[model samples]
Target: MRKLLSILMILLSIQAFAQDDKSKDRIDYSGEYNGTFTDIKDAEGTMQLFLYQPDKGRTSGIILLTRIVNGKSEVTTGTINIEGNGEFISGNFMPSEIKYIAPREDEDGIMQNTYDSYSCRWEIFGQITDKKGNTIIGKAVPANCVESNLIEFRINKKK
Candidate 1:
């Protein structure tokens, strides 16, 4: 009976160590990430992102700038909280809102000016790819606004 008890204790110790190591292997996504928005028309720009873990199952980041379309840009200098569930990523933003709506063509063959507020729920469906081509698929939901005036882009972490 003593030998059997000893074996059980050894198994429990091994399990505990395994759990500790697994937690230590958690990925650290806290850094400046450069990526492009890939799902928009005439969208060509890079975004600087700062990511951090505020608590368990919660990650937050901020976009320094979102340059989309020529001569048009939006600055999100405020903090945006993002949460992760499994392979999904989502968040929201406020205090930094700008809109660029499409101009309407008038009879004079000129575009009419129309100003609107920017409110969009930015959604990205892609993966974080490494230099070796390995990808970590995920999604991001921004809480800045409900409807965007311009097209959105999918971002892949830049190398």
Candidate 2:
């Protein structure tokens, strides 16, 4: 009975240490990331993202994108919050809310078709890669806009 009890205690101790080490092995994903997306027309756009994780399971960031519309360039910026699971090596991303920044008139008056208010709800689904610089591959869409096309994007972390 004494030997059996000792073995059980040793097993428990090993389990506890394993759990502790697992947490420490989680990847840190706080940095600037740049990505590109191809629209339905096959035109490519650029994405600049600043991401940080405040706590386990919660990742938040500011994102900016520039795309061509009707031969003109349009820029949009927003805030994104998502629930994260998996290490920085690879994982799932669940968006909580993605809201565009309040709009403003074209200050220079050189831009066309600009709006005073830009509203959008974005949904992004994808995974983080384990490759060099940890590339990100995903699909992004304007979830509330029916006319918007889905964009497939790949991003890499900046050094």
Candidate with top lDDT is 2
What is each predicted model's overall lDDT from 0 to 1?
Answer: 0.53, 0.67
Model 2: lDDT of residue 132: 36
lDDT of 1 by residue, 1-159 (tens): 999999999999999999888766555555556655433234445556676764344667776646554466655455656654334455554436555568789899987655422244454444445432223443334445433334344444445
Which parts of model 1 are misplaced by more than 4 Å?
Answer: 1-12, 54-57, 68-73, 81-95, 98-118, 131-159
lDDT for model 1, on a 0 to 1 scale? 0.53
Candidate 1 lDDT at 85 equals: 37
Pairs of residues clashing in candidate 1? 38-154, 90-141, 92-143, 93-143, 119-145, 119-146, 120-145
**Candidate 1 local lDDT, residue 122:** 52
Name the TM-score of candidate 2.
0.65
Q: Ten residues in a row with the worst lDDT in model 1?
A: 131-140
